[model samples]
Target: MSFLELSLTLHARQQERVELALEDLGALSITLRDADADTPDERAIFEPGVGELPLWNEIVLDALFDSAADRSGLVHALHELVPGLAPDRFTFREVEDRDWTRAWIDRFKPMSFGARLWIYPSTVAPGADDADKIIVHLDPGLAFGTGTHPTTALCLEWLDATDLEGRTVIDYGCGSGVLAVAALKLGALRVIGVDNDPQAIEASRVNAERNGVADRIDLHLPEDFPRRRENILVANILAGPLADLAPLFADCVEPGGLLALSGILQGQEGELLVRYAQWFDDLAVAVREDWVRISGRRRG
Candidate 1:
């Protein structure tokens, strides 16, 4: 079904208040984007952490409502609720429904993470020179971790460079199982992928099978996951959960095993370093754009 979408350009500071106002106004769904990003390559990432929203200086908030929503009344109410905003900032239109998943995947070009590893959408063709690189073919569908986002990119690069030979690994918050599968492809003896969502488990399974490493990987939900420790563990989730799961994560890695943590924003690493430092040593930081990855060896 088609829906009425109302887009508003405003200062970043007003986003939260406006988002609440939109929800109060009966918007079915809302999205925030960088208003000044006119280029196709620019993306909006909304990974929330402690007091973090990761937004540009100006934001374009889009609220979607049923086709029957009263446009004039809605605009009038927004003007009254959020005063001092220029009227020209408001734009409303009808948007046709689409298979969003297909649309997104169609645009996912082949990308290289580190020197030896590359990720290609099953729909796209890769370059001739990629014959020598370790390539991962992905049909991510509704699951996350395609190596496009910085969080997943950070993790994939770590997996690419690390020596996984004769080692077992754990991919916490496995998502599409990209990391678990990557670890296997990179010569890890075995990999255990853990995530809460059944869809994610299935996605990881499919990707692992596609890479011919299905037999070397195990997928599990958080509660069903075994208490066994491994030589390496990588988690690409938000900082809040990362901090809370530090103790569990430390236990998941054997003494002298390695740990890699992603999905953290730049300023938030200090808190994570302090939390993981309890059981981990020599925690090193890696930054890509606004994201950060923390790596260290569990204390022996």
Candidate 2:
């Protein structure tokens, strides 16, 4: 299916409000960008518990409009969400390639995390000799994750460095089930990946099989979250969701077990750390590019 692209520029402070409005209309994905494409000195978003999460003084919302109905739905939703805010300018055009997935493959490549891990997409791993590395086979097909992103890479590295042998692990917001699969590779006895998106869960299941560890990995939705605690838990979701899920993460990890989290802007780290401070001790962090990954043990 082809997608119609819609973009709008908004004041820095209004970006989140605009995103909420568009989300009410069901925007498949939204990304923030600078109008001038200027490289801001600060990070892009304020992430709690990471570095300083960027306040985003100015940004553009790039979203996909699947159809005319979708466009109308979004306009109506935005009007309702923000009583007076409307797009100052709007334009639409077909993305040329109906297969948006393939159009992006040229830019995607195998990424090495630190010096210990390398994530490989099935199509890109051919003739590679790093056979001993923790190789993850992800074919972005219909799913949303491949450990190439800084957030995912940070979390994967944490999992690799931690001692998971024979332990049970839970991957929260497990896009592509990459984290769970990585844990299994690191010797976790069993792992479960949970996400609200069914497509992500499906992709994760297939990827796990491709990695030859389907039997040890399970994928489900939030409604199906297991009742037991895991020895290690990891989540690479945004700061808001992470903060809201604190209690849940607290409940899911065994006492003294570690929880690694990412997908935060460098500035937001302090705020997020404060939220988790009560339940976790000695919150150590790992940094890659502009992203941050933090790990701490669940308090008993």
Candidate 3:
């Protein structure tokens, strides 16, 4: 498929009107990104909660239309709908669509964490040496956690280094079951995967099954969470929820168990360290790029 991509920048306040205008112009699809994303000071928006607009102060919208559409007509219509629309605001390019999944898989390749754990996409063939290394086969999908993001990479490194042999593990906020499946491959006896998104739970289950550890992991929504105290618990959710659920998380890990919290930005670790210190001892922090992972042992 081919498309004519029209890109322009607009203030967050004007997003709704611009989006409606693009739709009215028969745009096939629209993509919004932070216009100031190249600026180092711009904060990244990971995942927005339900009904929340994924917006920044300045947003760049790229509207796609049939390649044959009249470019001049689109420009005229947009300028008419938006008073004072600058001629410089509009940019055009022809784009060819390919299988996005295959494109992602090709770029992801094989990524290794810690001593012997590696994530491989289905397209790649592992070497004979992989017999000694723990392997996880994952495909790019709607759910998160493919070992690419700094946050997930930090958590995976923590999981890979930890001793999971014959222990029960909990993967709170398990996305795509990467950590849960990795823990199982690292020798964990059983894993409990919990996520609020039904799609995430399903993705986790499918990933677990794909790795031949489905029976060892149980996926659940928060409402039906078993809440069993486990030998190890790792949560790769944002810092806010990590702090809010501290007491609940504390209750989920038995005395003397292990824990790791991730999805925290660099400066945000201070509050989490203080809050988690109450129930966890020997707290330590690991940094990867701008992301932070805090690990500690449950106080006996």
Per-candidate Cα lDDT values, in order, are 0.79, 0.70, 0.80
* Candidate 3: regions farther than 4 A off: 1-98
> Distance (Å) between predicted and true CA of 104, model 1?
1.9
**Counted clashes in each candidate structure:** 0, 19, 0
Q: Name the candidate, 1 or 2, with the larger lDDT value.
A: 1
lDDT of 1 by residue, 38-145 (tens): 763584744233245646888878777657667886787566445667788899999987554454456567888898898888787677866788888885454556
Query: Over the stretch 1-300, how does candidate 2's per-residue lDDT look in tens digits?
Result: 677677776676666556544532334445566655555453253212222222455566676544433465456545544455555555555654355445344445787665456677666854656767777776544444466556777887787788888999989888667788878887899998898877678778888899899999878889988768889889987777888998888888888999999877577678889988889998987776556788899888
Query: How good is model 2 by TM-score?
Result: 0.71
Worst 10 residues of 2 by lDDT: 45-54
Candidate 1 residue-wise lDDT at 185: 80
Q: Could you report the Cα RMSD, in angstroms, for every candidate shown?
A: 9.9, 8.4, 12.1
lDDT measured at residue 299 in model 3 versus the true structure, 0 to 100:
96
